[model samples]
Target: MNPETIRRRRWYILGVLTFSLLVVVLDNTILNVALKTIADPQEGLGATQSQLEWAINSYTLVFAGLLFTFGVIGDRLGRKRVLVAGMVMFGLASLLSAYSQSPAQLIGARALMGLGGAAIMPQTLSIITNVFEPQERGRAIGIWSGAVGLAIGIGPITGGLLLAHFWWGSVFLINVPVIVVGAVLIALLVPESRNPDPGRLDPVGVLLSIVGLVTLSYGIIQGGERGAWLEPGVLGPIAAGLAVLALFARHEARSDHPAFDVRLFRDPRLSAAVAAIALCFFAAAGMFFFAGFYLQSVRGLSAFQSGAMLLPFAVAQILFSTRSAAMVHRFGAKAVCATGLLLVAAALASYPVLGIGTGTPLWVLGAVFFVQGAGMANVMPPATESVMSALPREKAGAGSALNNTARQVAVAMGVAVLGSVLASIYRGELAERLAALPPGARTVAAESIEGAHAVAERLGAAGQGLIGPANAAFTEAMRTAAGAAAVIAFLGALVVLKWMPGRTAHREPERAERAERAERGTGREKARGRRAASRERTRV
Candidate 1:
């Protein structure tokens, strides 16, 4: 009843939200390390390039595809109800993922997990919008955003440790207990909230959206892996995906109750927020995807070791997440976003040089990741704040969902694009280096390199001398790949800076109303905390 009691309860609510988010985010990153393990279980899953691609992209594809629809579902049904339902589904999917017998099976299970993720992911931000006040919302969202960074930050390390001790399935299994605890706490403490006049579900719009996203995602995913844009297999899905998206757009424009108001593009703040989500995640996902290879293939780190090496990134993000919010409030999202993107670009560019040797100095890699992490810290929270602040209270679910969808889509595309680039360069460079060798040596080299081996076997004593040059070539190629990706990300920052609305002198009534909802959210957060503490005490 009292403010003090409410404050205590607020933290408990954040705990549940954070825990749920951890499951979603951890799944996203943990798979980065587990990919090799899952693919090549005996000599490390020996997963083909295509299979590896699917392992990462399948979850993202499903996550991105269903985000908008589930967001609407949350609005129409209830955010809490949707989240609880999603958690149950996600837990079951995780179990399925653990038992996967093949890469195809794992990919299928991951897709199912994404389906649940689509339902679970948006609520975390929407709830902050639902509960926290405007002034406090910025800070609350910062903390919420930080939790995401933490999950990503720790994912590799945690996954590596689990993999080292158990099987690849352990990473998925870890989500089980966390989700169970989160579900109970969320049910008890978080209040049921939804749109007051939720719009009707637009099946036509949903169909279009699904078609467009699937097509678009399939194109990028396939093109990136195969290193050719015109491959019929790649182009077919992309073309169909685009055609379906175009139809979806037309339907949304005409529909009475569109799945989303496509007209929101008119709002610079919303547009910038959407673009920022796309670009930021594009860079972030690329870094995560490639860094795994750099650490494992190039640097010769174990899965656990590579995950540990990423600590600087996680630590920097957690340290600066709240600070990023303050900077956004002071300088505005556009300035903060621009600065962040520049830093990310710089970090990406640095990779080519820093990626060179097996014994790369820890401080050098750490510094680069720290800068990238700081940028990431800025980009994520500021972008979320921009979108949530741009919309009315009633539209938070849809808005948040849209923002998250962009991110999911970007992540999938980035990995496909950047991952493809990295793979191609690595393969081509390896091929060229092997070209000078004898027939048997070349065969051994190609097979060995394809399997992530740093050096070939048949060359023996003579080949040992060539490892330095080959490694250098591969690193240089990755550098080129990473740099190009960075340029695209920087361009994304520019789009945000030029497009988002300028900060006003005063907060609007809608902003104030949103702030009030945020306060109520804080109340619910407190309620959840009290219940969690009580449970702890009872257990004691």
Candidate 2:
């Protein structure tokens, strides 16, 4: 497409991109509400807890693993081509997931969806970077970030509604229509773009990165699932993954045609922004994981009700994210990001105050969610702009991949680390109470709040006594985890404040104006010299 056409239809193109992104992100969270249903022996597939975890982790591992590879592929081939192909793959995968005969089939299908998601994600951001001018990119990115928040907030609610009306598979099936519509709009409106000078393929680098990231993600997921980081099952893969990643970095640094340039991280703008994204997500994802349990198990709210309660968060995200560009324009990225992180920290810190009781008003939790959402709204757009701006437009795919990979890795780490903390604290608090129960019941009661609740229901009168202590222990654990997350978010704020550039939005115009003035002054001086030379010639 021509530049004029692209400019004219840019907003439309953004809409299509956001729609496509919504499905991918929505899928990430949508499965949460369906996990209970999918575990039922009669109503759905009888998936074990471990199988359910794999249903989620399989997707995550594949998505994180392939992101960089697909990003490089998009740059080398064509972004539009890759995007359409990914959407098609995602649609087919969703269909397969919906119709899967068993848990194993669903896991495999979800992995295929991840493969498509990786292909779709980087291309969207790169295309936006290429389409919008520097002046408008921040606003575009803010909107894109808002869509992500929207998807996350709605995913569970959508899943709950689908499961209520249809089946557990309906959550996966819902993506098909949306993908079809997106594919049509994408074909019609989105233009193809690629690197003019994409370097030669680095097969070794790609292979190393895939192995490193997948192994690392597997280790993290295993740690979370088992709640044991030091076990050989967890520690071994993590160590090996780190070693492989180190080798990958070394190879990239040495390669003549590196797939991902390790050198790009030298820029503080890119590096600091990437750090901020990773840290904030690390903090937030943990909070989200525990909050779901708190809402459902502790408070006795249904999945649909819990999902509805989070609407405030989505509202706050949409409102602030759309306006964050203006905030950045005024206060600058550094101020905005630091302030945002501070808000997130404050929100996280407030969780403990809600306490362990059902008496704690739900509205207070909603308010905290709103604040957290607003804080995140302010952070993402500025950080994303910084990442994209640090790279040449043609390298936007790599930059996008880097930003996303940091987030995915951090999310996995957050869930693992905070989950372990929660488990340890809860087990300690409830150990004496659990010992009073039968051996089989003791193990079940000690596992998780949900498990304790299930055992309570089964015991009838005997289980009634177990409920209060389980609630208390889980609440205490949640509070401690939230406090830890707050500290992490505060650290992110400090990092942004120290390293990210301040007030560059204002300074950039001043620098440009000064350059223009200098050019004009030079032109006038030459004009005067030419006039004087002409006068001298006439005199002669």
Q: Which candidate ranks first by lDDT, i.e. highest?
A: 2
The digit string of per-residue lDDT tens for model 2 on 182-284 reads 9999999999999887657788987887788767766765665565678999999989989999999999999987766778889998888999999998898
Give the Å shift of residue 365 in candidate 2: 0.5
* Global fold similarity of model 1 (TM-score): 0.87
- Backbone clash pairs for candidate 2 read none
- Judged by whole-model lDDT over C-alpha atoms, candidate 2 comes out at 0.84
Q: Deviation in angstroms for 391 in model 1? A: 1.2
Off by more than 4 A, model 1 = 1-8, 41-44, 353-359, 433-470, 505-540
Tens-place lDDT digits, model 1, residues 192-260: 788889877777776677667767776776675565678899889888888888888888778878775
Candidate 1 residue 266 Cα shift, in angstroms, is 1.1
On the 0 to 100 scale, the lDDT of residue 347 in model 2 is: 91
lDDT, each prediction: 0.78, 0.84
10 residues in a row with least lDDT, candidate 1: 446-455
